[model samples]
Target: METTTATGGVDEPGWDVDPDDEIASVVEALGHQQKRWREAAGLGVAEFATAMGYGEDQVRKVERGARIPRPEYLDRADEVLGANGFISAMKEQMAKARYPKKVRELAKLEERAVELSLYSNHNIHGLLQTEEFAWALLSTWRPALSKSELERAVAARVARQSVFERSPAPELSFVQEEVTLRRPIGDTMVLRRQLERLLEVGQLSNVELQVMPTLRGNHPGTAGLIEVLKFGDGTAIGRSEGAFASRPVSSPRQLRVLELRYGIIRAQALPPGESLAFIEQVLGET
Candidate 1:
């Protein structure tokens, strides 16, 4: 609910799409329609904002399409501007734009995955992150987030765990760096809770959790985080992201290479039973 503006005049916690993109165009069109309706109702930004119970700056930003308006914002704008259902009807489109584009794309990929292999060299995988742990991890992100943005991301990341509860759940495997488990990103309590969550998840029939010991010298996963998602139709795609940007690897040759490296990393990691024991030991020390 809290918001801030930077010196450049953009909302600190808002989303942005390329100006010429289709989504941007739709948002702009909606904004223009709202402005026209407000003008027809003989209301300035201040009056419209006061009627809508939002800040005047927010009113201006929404009308300029510089901010992605939530459903409630659109509904209030509709009532205050006398646009009836017209303004609020854009809710569906805005909803699709709610999450960052990259997140949406990744989420769609996850939806079709029948099995997933994940190797984390740093933080816990998003699908396995506890709410408090995710909040702690995201809060320290370099660019920083507005309170609202942070909450949105944390919710999205945690929601991904629903995959674990799916009927005929997808097979899932995770190999996390030992250091990631040891680092108390949040205080001791948060880290302990997260480790406990991992222990619970590791017990699932379709899930396997492994840990790569810090004592182990250089390994295949030292390159960064690697993820390969396998679909029911025998197709698989992968990517490794760390110092370099991520790109999908669907070509059979590339997938084979990634699979080979991932196989080696898995071999190097502690087995699931040993990994659970290690986690329990860490939890006790905590």
Candidate 2:
């Protein structure tokens, strides 16, 4: 049996939350494995879906693990597709899947990013979030966690900010919808401290803050938020839970679409010089 030795009574890393989390990751692992098996077998999703007595849509969902494959479904799929043990092996990996895969990808990207650009709709972007904000946000998730879990989550999020202080720090730019400033996430004090932090943050030459106003008539990004990242290699990617539907889009076609919208939004937004004043204005309003 594998052993986990404690150091000063601290739990070791790699422990998972629950069966659900493990199952979630396995769902993804299964999906990827199934896709590989299908390719090796020279089959298409539609063809495989038909063979397995499932619709194309359901097949896609199964592969993505957005929908669990019922035991009967899995048995039939395994029999028809010849993926003998893939689904069963996911029991451990699924525990890691409770969180969204896109979220985990974003975390990894943030850690390695040399620059990050943010645009938000309903809430403050994660990189700018404070402990109180993060705790409140995570606590509101369904299948609620205990206080210790929430703290761990909050700490994990806050610790991610250290990338900002690394040698030759990454550039950070934020574009927030004007409504966020008025939302009042925490109480007055928390909100005030947050806004003050924003001011201090905005003062950094490597950081910029911009606000998109309601007055800027409806446009592309009017639908949701986006984040564009430029990495150390100087390759850039654009992401929005929007157009390519939240998938990581490094393709020129997708990036151009997002790039065009981001450009217009920036133009309609208060420029950096005015943005400082705008942040101060909201701070005064609080």
Candidate 3:
């Protein structure tokens, strides 16, 4: 039999709640409520843990707001403490709290974008990556992340895919370096699936996917990645690795520079139809 952690799932650990997170107060309040309900029922920590089928330490962490309780844990606690549906109702908020801060911020920006222009030289853009591909790529980070951290990061990346499902979808344009397609981040099958995903996304009416061949020779994108997001309010934000210290810029002058670079990069890349064919060929080779 496999040993399970206090989080209840096999080999899965509870997420450590970040005290500085924006949702920290909400989680703390929920934890306090859980504790109050248990005490009102005249249950001690050990007794409560036994009732909920979790370890005492884990239960203590949840009550102290140091660990984020999983949905099942919340449901069990609600049933055991007779809180009715109150404890379980916090699951949706807790789910959002589990994602990293940066992911949440970026997702909000993507949600507001009416048009997105992007150029990625090192790897496939996050929006175009498959779940397995994202996992394999993130796993290569130095000073390796813990299992809980890795799973959370992958979840955050995959969650951004919701942008593709939005009604009146945003116009998405992407230019990827030739090498990104050839590099197998996970395994043969992983790369194949990722390539297939690119083909499918490329076919979307609102999306245009292009590839910059390795021999394309000294382009504006050679310096690094570029991104520009335009909104309906006649405002835009942009950033380029080679300019503005790579920080986001919103002034028209700065935005214009990034747009120009991105425009040239797109023009130099393979056309959408040819790019899809190229990706399909790469998939076959895989």
Q: Pick the candidate with the highest TM-score.
A: 3
Residue 20 local lDDT, model 1: 56
Query: What's the best-to-worst order under TM-score?
Result: 3, 1, 2
lDDT (C-alpha, whole model) for all candidates? 0.82, 0.69, 0.86
Off by over 4 Å in 2: 1-103
Write down the lDDT that model 2 would get: 0.69
Clashes of each: 0, 14, 0
Give candidate 3's error at residue 59 in angstroms.
3.0
Highest-lDDT candidate: 3
TM per candidate comes to 0.72, 0.63, 0.85
The predicted structure with the larger lDDT, 2 or 3, is: 3
True lDDT of residue 166, candidate 2: 73
Q: Write the per-residue lDDT of candidate 2 for residues 149-191, one digit (tens) a residue.
A: 5554565567567667777888887888888777767678777
Q: How much does candidate 3 score in TM-score?
A: 0.85
lDDT of 1 by residue, 1-286 (tens): 4454442222322344456555677777777998999999999887776677677787777778877787777887788777879988988677656556568677767878999999998898898889999999999998999777786677567656768877778999999999989888899999999999999999999999999999887788888899999998999989987422678878888888788888999999999999999999989988
Q: Which order, best to worst by lDDT?
A: 3, 1, 2
